[model samples]
Target: MGTIKRDKGLDNTLKVMKQGYLYITNQRKRLGSENIFETRALGGKKIIVISGKDAAELFYDNDKIERSGTLPKRVVNTLFGKGAIHTTTGKKHIDRKALFMSLMTEGNLKHLRELTRNHWYMNTQKMEQMDQINIYRESIVQLTKIGTKWAGVQAPEEKIEEIATDMDVMIDSFKGLGGKFKGYKASVDARKRVEDWLEDQIIQTRKGKIFPPEGTALYEFAHWEDYKGNPMDSRLCAIDLMNTFRPLIAINRFVSFGLLAMHEHPITREKIKSDDDYAYMFSQEVRRFYPFVPFLPAKAKTDIQFEGHPIEKDTMIALDIYGTMHREDVFENPDDFYPERFKDWDGSPFDLIPQGGGDYYTNHRCAGEWMTIIIMEETMKYFAERVTYDVPEQDLTVDLNSIPGYVKSGFIIENLREVV
Candidate 1:
């Protein structure tokens, strides 16, 4: 096997923290490797970064790559709680993932879509009464209520915003390492608060103090069993329960970006009002053009050769999710924010994976992906068709170097007027 150029650094953990989303893509460009490049990150471990269509295929291969011990401990305690679906693999993964897949049933997803639409409509009504509003924070409040209700988690309207605030703080901590000590501490505290609350709920349900309806996330997770038919620790079960509904609130970032897109492209904004199919394309474009997840790291399950070079077993590898979607070969004039590109696009899971590539039912792909698109499409539809507002002058720049990049101004809108 031939040797690929390796990054000249003893350890690249600091660089990865500094560069964030662009670290892998920048290295690939500098090394001039179209598909694969080598580097060391997260404390001098051998790591290879891969992009493009073929690389995506290999990255998601269950037999060739694994998820055990892939993510950093800080990310786990802060963003995704321990024992969440993002960590487990093999039969253990499949079994745990089934809990989420079950929640994604057509009936449940339809309910979620209806919930999204109703909440957006109400927010517009409220906005009409107010002088101005920040779409980012407002949508979080709206989605948190919707998500909690749909999951059968009994939380009051007043407490919903507080919970959303905690969840948002946890998600924002994963963006970059700047001021991470304070951010990390906040996130860890948030997780503990939420998890402790969820644990109490679990106990109440078991003791018959609270009896949530069957098939709801609260009820299912309270009774979910592992591969050995044993109940999960109450604390860990709370983590799994939190995973069921927290992702719905994450759609606030996409909603903020989608509104920004409409303001930037008036012609595209007007088109979605009349074309239902175009609205779907617009949502897809927002996911592609804007950044969400940057890269997903996995460990090589076996010794493998790619691009005439050897990748030893246990080597840390990452799939360049954001870079792959914007590759010139993958999408013509990829940098442009055109929704029409998806009109005739073939449905390949690997090409446009802001969420993750491969079969949603099987791989590490987000089970809530379909729900994300639905909620985004509904929110965009509401903004395009239901109301008219003005985008006030503000800093709308998107910082790509952040893990969960978003508009700097949170896409503020003022002078809300309803349209018949």
Candidate 2:
């Protein structure tokens, strides 16, 4: 009998080192490796990393590689559905991404940022009334309501509150609540609410009761195609938008965390605040330090041999963002939260990927990364300077199995009594 080895849930890649890539173990006990030269994990699912700028290049490389198969698709269908971003790959993914990018131009983004600033100011003003507030949770609710709504999507306020409540319930359950059964129930309930809301929105938009602006990414995505080449039905587009929206919500949740990091590390915060381009640098560093996603899961595309390892097709491969970010060989003082490190680095792009690199748009790369950076930079600076928060004794919690966390939304930010 073949004995099964359970997944140990370690930073799999971090534990093993080979010539080009580090090895990882899947649930099936398959081993794969990823490194500077090439990536072959889950038996033989293959990709290349090469260096830092290569990371970005790989992200933009759409023609040769794409996101497909069971793991990613299943997760998307379960969590995000067949939306414009996660549901499709290749040319279609590029087209959809292009639409999103085009809509994310400086002018549109500038407008979005202005509205966001107003929203943040308003929210923060309300928070100041209480000496102590849960900035993390409050930020999540505010960002979901204000952030996406400002981005031109009409997210229902009540629904946003419900989802926030559900998420918290699950988190509480994870932290060991006995009665709620919160994790399982919240996941199931949230999916239903998301589906119902998406259906209503699609029907409403189709009937012309609402119309997104002509160049709006969501508007374009309403007619996007899937890998099978059919235009995404309005229903699917609605579902997809929700999926895209979730990450934005999550990223913003951490934007508050980034602000906390900066406020605590005054020297780093002040340095970033002092320069124009440095704001972006700071945001990148924040992304690196407290990334929204740690494991980017992918499946093997075909059967192939790589680096003398025989990996079968269809195995699950999880790319390690946390490990890569902290790898000493790649970044000097790997654990330090230094935004300026990127400013001086001349390495390839593959080395520093908070976002997945190489053909990732069609794979697992984030569509809203540009907007995420913009929002983080804007939000981080605003809070670091204008708002001050008193964090609890815990600085950051290491999720060990998931994304790294520090100073979760458990603290209160004081000062600045009203939004302008």
lDDT scores for all predictions? 0.85, 0.54
The C-alpha stretches of model 2 lying farther than 4 A from their native spots are: 1-66, 70-74, 82-84, 156-160, 163-182, 223-231, 303-315, 345-348, 359-363, 392-395, 399-409, 415-420
| Tens-digit per-residue lDDT, 1-420, candidate 1 | 557777779778778766767777788888877888887766677888888988899888888888778887788778889878788888888888888788887888898889998988887778998777899999899889988888888898879878999989888766633234568878888899999989999999888899988888888888888889987788888898888778778889999999998998998878998887988999999999998888888888999777777888998998999999989999899989999999998989889999898987679888888888889888898889889998888999998876678899998999888897
lDDT (Cα, tens digit) per residue for candidate 2, span 310-418: 3345544445555567666667887788888878766444666776654333445566667777777777767755565555554455334332343544445545443
Error of 2 at 266 (Å): 1.6
The C-alpha local distance difference test score for the whole of candidate 2 amounts to 0.54
Model 2 earns a TM-score of 0.74
